[model samples]
Target chain A: MATLSIENAGKSFGDTDVLKDISLSMDDGEFLVLLGASGCGKSTLLNMIAGLEKVSHGTIRVDGEVVNDVHPKDRDMAMVFQSYALYPNMSVEKNIAFGLEMRGVGRAERKAAVEEVARLLQIEHLLDRKPAQLSGGQRQRVAMGRALVRRPKIFLFDEPLSNLDAQLRVEMRTEIKRLHQTLKATMVYVTHDQIEAMTLADRIAVLKDGRIQQIGTPSEIYNTPANVYVAGFVGSPAMNFFEVTLERDGDQIGVMLPAKLKGVDTPYFLPLPAGGQYHSHIGQPVVLGLRPEMISQATTAAPEDPVITCDVDVVEPTGADTLCVIRLAGRGAKARVSPAFACEPGDSMEFALDMSRACVFDAETGMRLYG
Target chain B: MPQPKGGSSHRTVLDKLSRFLPQLVVAPSFLLILFFVYGFIIWTGYISFTDSRMLPAYEVQGFRQYFRLFAMDRWDVAFDNLLVFGAFYITLSLAIGCLLAVLLDQRIRAEGALRTIYLYPMAISFIVTGTAWKWMLNPSLGIESYIRGLGWESFRFDWIVDKDMAIYVVVIAAVWQASGFVMALFLSALRSVDQEIVKAAYLDGASTTRIYLGIILPSLRPVFLSAFVILAHLSIKSFDLVVALTGGGPGYASTLPANFMYEMTFRRNQIGLGAASAVMMLLTVAAIMVPYLYSELRGKRHA
Candidate 1:
């Protein structure tokens, strides 16, 4: 419905700068998610785009028109808040119909709009009930229904599922995705939950310290993170990092891990050819990045490949896969292995490190070296 | 779940009696709230059904004083004055208090100073606010006089004088005194809101007004109801403010129920009729307060 463009947007509250130099453009009907932890200024950025909070410095445009002076109501956008924010005194029908009534929609049309969205949200039975009487999940639907009745050019969600239980969060996440497909409306959602960003967003903007770390498709961010922080922050159980020195053994290039380094058991000899991203950093200390899923139980001996053996310290069996914690090089390392092997605490296990997909980063700068 | 044999709940009968003995020592003060509070109320209701003299005797002559109460034009005016005052007082106080609380809750600078300014009125006694407002609204001695001296002699601050418009002034004064309390309650409630709710509303593209009126105000319904009941009851039984400010003067233009009942009991010595009016006022308070108390207790129990 509307393309949103934010150019070098920043926010400062008196002396505290919450956001800085944030520039992003969203296509029409795009589902953009601003993902960050609390106080990272994701909500402040969303408010700036909505014409709710003034941009301390920069410009925001909706549908190619500058909205720096536009009123939020006049911006043709509807939002579903995490709290539901339904009027406590008004019934679900009245709450959903308020915006339409405010815009002078006819009585019959308003009723029809309310009924349609109520049905869509599976809340027809709750039409006469006030928000106080409804459960958290039901109140969320009413909030959605309220915004749906407006049919605005954009829909903004600020952690709408954060209030629900885990199962409900998942269900509502799918519901939101489905609703977007059916409506094809432009939407911007803000949440600290990375999984929500992963599942719901067409493009996820990962933020840290009031700056955009990376903005790309979820797959792109997952596979090729902009920096070390983005790599570790986007995944569950986090990616493993260890200081290793790049080395060249005749024809091939690899990084060697010591018998022990500090307290983390990291992989040994992650091979990256000399011509790839960090050829100039030979013998230099670089951090190795290995996703939990990529590290596998190594078997047999391969002289041509790099493999390491470590003492398994603990095993967390999650039915389908076992998270095996091992002490390699005097440090703790995690490997997601098949549960069939059945590892326990204090066992010697070998994990084969795959170099093709392994990432390398400058330890000091925390920027990714290998894509 | 090991049971404690010598726990606080397992006190002996003698220990329980010792604990309750201290309560007995303090029970006499409660008698003031019990007997003089309940006894006079029952005596008044009984005398209202009788043709008793100024000094009531236990002799009933069936609804005779009740008829007198209904026949009095002043009684009707007093009840109507209370309805108007209660409605406007409660509505205006809630609206202004909620607005001020939201403004303060927005992480504004000088929050402590602002809260002090807002809550200053609630800390002052109603008698004090009445005295202050009475002088402030006085035409010849206060704002009107001062303004006329500044060459606005044509401007009339005559709500204090007009019989028709006079009751609204009482509503305004009471709202001013009580809205501070409402603001305090709302500020606390706003602070206690799931901070995530505010973030959610903001991301949802809800304007500040929409977020407050639509999201924040609804979430604060419990506090609103509490403030409403308190201010409503205060408006209904307001005597000090009316008497201190207007003295029910300009020909009883600002007469409320409590003041009228006071006039009947102390000035006119119409004990039977005054008692009836008092009973009616109690019932009126009960009508609003009972459900309010019930809901508050039940919500707590549920929580």
Candidate 2:
């Protein structure tokens, strides 16, 4: 229900900087997720937003009012911790109504609010039970119910689904996304899981080593990552990298493939789709990045899309798609192919590479060079 | 192939010894406890029903010792004093212990040193504690004369010699010697509590006092029960503190049940009455312990 903005927020513990120059603004009713590996300062940033942690230097504003020094209770935000953090001694109903009771809401009103949230979470029968009586997923619902009952200006979730089992985590992830959609509340979530980020967030902010690597919509982050790190981090069977030199052959600029192919007698030239864009980098070594799905079983294609032969080293079937490992530029690279396009290990297979969808990065900087 | 039977027989002997080793090691202590503790309890139970004076008399008498024990004014006073002492000792100790633990839980800079200082009293025996407090409470030698010497003409601070208030002095000494232990129990439980619960309560707008009273303290129900059972047994069995401090002084006003039993058995040579009172004390302790043990074991199984 409120637009939140943080300006140049930084945090340091004694001599070590934990977060630096974190600046982002959220629109009202937006769902933003901070995605990163452990120790990436995502949880720290979320804590700062909740006012549970002091920002060593920065200004945080809510709805155009500076709230840099406001207490967590006065910041008008609710946090669902990873552990659920329900009052172990209180019944589920009491746990949901605790904040309202603290605010001095009437008994009748508190009961109605608790019942409504219990029904919303489909945990009406569990209201009388203590937290220890409930399962992990049930406790998660009660935790969310507690946060939702207050209707705070902002909702902060610090990996609320991290404690649940795989099946229950997916179910709770859907439930959280549905709640965000129904309430249209401003929510900020922190998680190390990219799948949850891709599925639940309107925009994902990828972080590493206490700094934001990139912030954009899920598709933008996946299809056009800002750097090789972002590209490799967001996808499963992570993007493959191959070192090659950008060479121009009669105005057709592209990366050169090694002669390491099983059936090839000499190195091959793989032309770029829009060859002129990379002409300035001719003769410079660059890293080519491509998703596993971009390379598949060979098919009749246009001249821009090239097919090359390589020896398959391994085959893995994942029900929906089959993955084959092949030697490319003297490194094992995974290529996802249709399960029907079967190839066994030690067999030479022809696969087509989609150059337009591929990504190119500077070998030295690991930054995106061309897409 | 010819030696396989010999090897198997040798392994069987070793296996049997391994199975029997634990019981063999435990037999001595088990037998000692059974004879010294439970054996004396049965002997005492039998003696309570006999007309024994100065020593064990084998002639069984029917309910006469209990009748005499119930009728004595000294026994009546000792029973009443046990209640008063137990009430004040358990409640005041618990209140003070909980307060100290909560204050020390605030991440203070000198927590280690302060906790050690608070807990030092429990390390001293009740006799030592009583002797020290006796010197401090003596009207002429300790606080009263020292204060009067500082220019006040009248400073009366002699609870140890006061007959009506002597039991309270016993309670004070016992609480001082035991509250530190209660504080240690509560402090360990307080340390194990999930800290995220406290943070959540803070965000829910709970003040520090309300958070403690409503959320944190209620979760420590087990600790409270444990402290109650421990303190209850200790108060019922209190003897040395009263002996060393007040000596049940100014009459038999401050005598607890244990002291009464000792007086009747050793000093008065009324063995029957002493055994009757000792059996009553055992029953009281059992009454508190049985339910606590039952609930504790049942809770573990459920968990």
| Model number with the top lDDT | 2
Fnat per predicted structure, each in turn: 0.24, 0.68
TM-score of chain A of each: 0.94, 0.97
Task: Itemize residue pairs with steric clashes in candidate 1.
Answer: A259-A329, A260-A329, A263-A331, A264-A331, A264-A332, A265-A331, A265-A332
**Model 2 segments beyond 4 Å from truth?**
A259-267, A300-303, B1-3, B149-153, B301-303
TM-score: model 2, chain A: 0.97
Q: What does candidate 2's lDDT look like per residue over A182-212, in tens digits?
A: 9999999999999999999999999988888
What fraction of the true Cα-Cα contacts (under 8 Å, chains A to B) does candidate 1 also have? 0.24
B14-105: candidate 2 lDDT, tens digit per residue? 99999999999999999999999999999999999999989999899989999999999999999999999999999999999999999999
Report the number of clashing residue pairs per model. 7, 0
The Cα error of candidate 2 at residue A138, in Å, is 1.1
